[model samples]
Target: MIRKELLSKCKEALTTRQSELIKQVQDHFGMKYEFAKETSGELSNYDNHPADTGTELFEREKDLALNEHAEKELEEINEALHAIEEGTYGICKICGADIPNERLVAVPTTDTCVEHAKNETFNRGRPIEEEVFSPNINPDEVTDEEQVGYDAEDAWQEVSRYGTSETPSDFYGDKEHYNDMFPNSDENVGSVEDLENFLAADIHGKFIGVAPNHDKHEE
Candidate 1:
C-alpha cells in the first residue's frame, strides 16, 4: 500500500507544477496564438519580403507549439490531481497493480506504472509492405526464369549510371563517384567481353583492326 504522506507530497508537487506551467504559458506565449500580421505589428504581410514573412511565421509556429505542449502537460497534471481525489492515485489503470512509491515520487502526473505507461506491451505493429516483400534485394541478382540475360537488372544499371537513390555508403567497397555506386558498374554494357568493345570485325566475320575505347582504354 502507498503511504498517505507520499500521496500528499505528490499532490503538492502536481499543484506546484500546474501553477508554474500556467504562468509560463501566460507570460511566454500569451499572444502567440494571435494572427501573424497582428503579432508582427505590421500593417500588411503583402509589404514584407517572403524570407522575412517566413521567419516570422516560423517563430510564431514555434511559440504556439511550445504553448500547446505546456497546456497538454497541465491537463495531465489536472487528471493526476483528480485521480488522487478519487482515491486511485497509486493504482495502475491498465493492470490494477499498485504503482511503486518511487515512480509516483519521480513523475507525480503519471497514473500508470512504468511498464504500461511506456507502451512496451502495446503492439505498435509493422508496415504492410513486410507481408509481401523480402528484406533483402540484390541489385545485380535476378530470380525470374524467363528474364535470361540483359534483363531488368541491366536496365536498372543503365538508368543508375545517370543517378540512383543508392549512395556510396550503401556499397561495401569504396565508391568515389555517383556513376560508380551501382553494383557490377564496371562490367561491360553492350558487349559480352571487354575486348569485343574495341575489336572490330568485318560483316563477313573476318578479323579487322583494333580501335581503342577512348573513355576506358586510358584506365
Candidate 2:
C-alpha cells in the first residue's frame, strides 16, 4: 500500500512528464510538416546526381524516424498518467512487486522494474525475415563437389573482379600481363570444367600440348 503523500508525489511527477512529452510531440509534428514542405519544394530528376538525391532521402527518413519516436514516447507518458489515476502507477507490470521509488523517479513511464525489463533492452528472438532469406552457407562445411554451383572460390573471384591489393609486380610466377597476375593463372583458373585446366597457347606461336591428368590416370 502506497502512502497518500508518496502517491501524490508520483502523480505530480507523472503529470509534469506527460505535459513535457505533449509539448515534444507537438514540436516533432511541426518539424515533420516543415520538412515535408521543404522536400516537396526541392527538384529531383535524372539530371541531378544520384548521391544528391540519396542524401535528401536519408535526411527525410531521419526526420520521420525522430517524429515517430517522439510520438511513441508521448503515448508511454500518457499511459503512465492513466496508470497513476488507476492507483497502479508504481507497481511493476511483469512481476507483482512495488517498483523502487528511485527507479520510478528516474524513468517515470516504465511499467516494469529493471530486473523484469528484458524488452526494454535486448530483443530476445531472431527476426521473421531470417526464415525467408537464410544466412550464408558456412565456408568450412562446403564440399568439393559444391564448388561448381556456389563456393568460397567463386565468391572470391566475383569480389576480385572489382579489384585487389596485389598487382602484377606482387605475382610469384611469370606474369607477362596484368591479367596473368591473379593466383592460379593456369589450370582451371576461372572455368568449372577439368578440360579447361590445360587449354592454353604460348605467345611464341608454339603448340602448348594438353598434359594428361595424372589423377585420372592413377584412377
Candidate 3:
C-alpha cells in the first residue's frame, strides 16, 4: 500500500502536470489555427514562385507535427489523472511493482517502472518500405548485365556525363586537361561492347576509329 503522504504528493504533481498539459494543448491549437489562417491566403496564388510554395508547405507540415505531439502528450496526461482516481497512479502497470518516488516525481504521467520503461523507447524495427524497395546497391559490385538495364550506378554515370561541379583541379590524380577530370576517363569507353567503344561510323557510312589509349592507325 502507498503511504498517504506520498499519495498526496503524487496527486498534487499529477494535478499540476494535467493543468500544464491542458495549457500547452490550448497554445498549440491556437498556433495551428493561426498558421492555417496565414497559409490559406497563400494557397490561391498562381503567380507565386515554386520556392515560395515549397516554404509554405514546409511550415504547414511543421505545424501539423507540433500539434500532433502536443495532442499525444495531453492524452497521456489525462490517462495519468484517470489512474490517480482508480488508486493505481504510482504502481507500475507492466511489472506490478511500486514505482520509485523519484521516478514518479520525474515523470508523473508514466505508469511503468524503469525496467519496463526501457522497452517503450524508440522502435528498432526497419520500415516496411525497405522490404519492398531495396536501398542502393554498391556501384563496384554491379554486374555487366545489371549495367545494361536501369541500375543505380548506371543512373549515376548517366547523370555524371552531363557534367558536375568538380573541375580538373579538384580531381584526385594527375589530370592534364578537363577531359581527364572525369573518373576512369582514359578507359571509360561509353559503350558496353569493345567494338562500339573504339569505333563509330560517320554520316557517309565510313567507319571512324576513336579509341583514346590505343593507336587508331595500327595495321
Candidate 4:
C-alpha cells in the first residue's frame, strides 16, 4: 500500500514535469515558426537579403530536431503514465526490483534502474577488440562508407603469428545461467528463503508467472 502511494505521488510529479516540457516545446515551436515565417516574408520584399532566408531555414531545421526529440519524450512520458494506470509502475524491467525512489523521481519514464540504464551498458554483445576496436590498419585515414573493420581474431593472428580459427565464446548473451549465485539483492536482504516467503504471487495486480527469480521474490 505504501509503495502504491509512493508510485502515485511519483507519477503525479512526472505528469507535471511532462506537462511543463510540452508547454515549453509548443511555445518554442510556435515562436520560432512565426519568427522564421516573418523573416522569410520580410526577406521576400527586400532588395537583396539572402541571409534572412538562410536564417529561416536554419531555425526551421533546428526546431525540427527539437520537436522530434520532444515528441519522443512526450511519448515516453505517456507510456510511463499508461504503465502506472496498468499498475506496473516502479518495477525495473531488467531486475524486477522496485526501482529506487530517487530514480523514479529523477526519470519517471525510465523502465530500468540507473545501473541498468541503456546508456550505461558495459559489455555489449560483441567481444572487446573484435567488437569496436577492430584492426586492419589504415587508422591513419578514415572513409565515410562502412565504419567497420576486421575481427579481433584476424588482428591477433596477424600481430602474434600464432592463433586458432575457433570463434570466441559470446559473453554478452542474455542467458539465464549463473543466476543461482546472485539472488535479487533488493528482495533477499535477510535469509533468502524467508524473503521468498514474503513475495506475493500477484504483485500489485501484475502477474509475472513461473520465473525462478519471481518465485524467489514474491511476497
Tell me the tens digit of each residue's lDDT in model 2 across 114-140.
888865467678889867544553444
lDDT of 4 by residue, 56-140 (tens): 6787778778878888888889888888887778887788777888878777788887777887557646656655554454352
Please give the CA lDDT of all the candidate structures: 0.78, 0.68, 0.69, 0.61
> Model 2 segments beyond 4 Å from truth?
3-9, 27-40, 120-219
Full candidate order by TM-score, most accurate first: 3, 2, 1, 4
Task: Encode model 3's per-residue lDDT on 81-173: one tens digit a residue.
Answer: 798789888899988999988887778788898998956477788889867645654544435435664555545565665677678667677
RMSD per model, one decimal: 10.0, 9.7, 8.3, 28.8
**Angstrom error at residue 27, model 4:** 8.5
User: What are the TM-scores, per candidate, against the unseen true structure?
Assistant: 0.51, 0.53, 0.55, 0.45
Candidate 1, residue 55: CA error in Å? 1.7
TM-score of the candidate numbered 2? 0.53
Error of 4 at 97 (Å): 2.2
Candidate 1 residue runs with Cα over 4 Å from true position: 25-28, 31-33, 118-219
Candidate 1 colliding pairs, count: 0
Score residue 128 of candidate 3 by CA lDDT. Answer: 90
RMSD (CA, angstroms), candidate 3: 8.3
Residue 40 lDDT, candidate 2, scale 0-100: 49
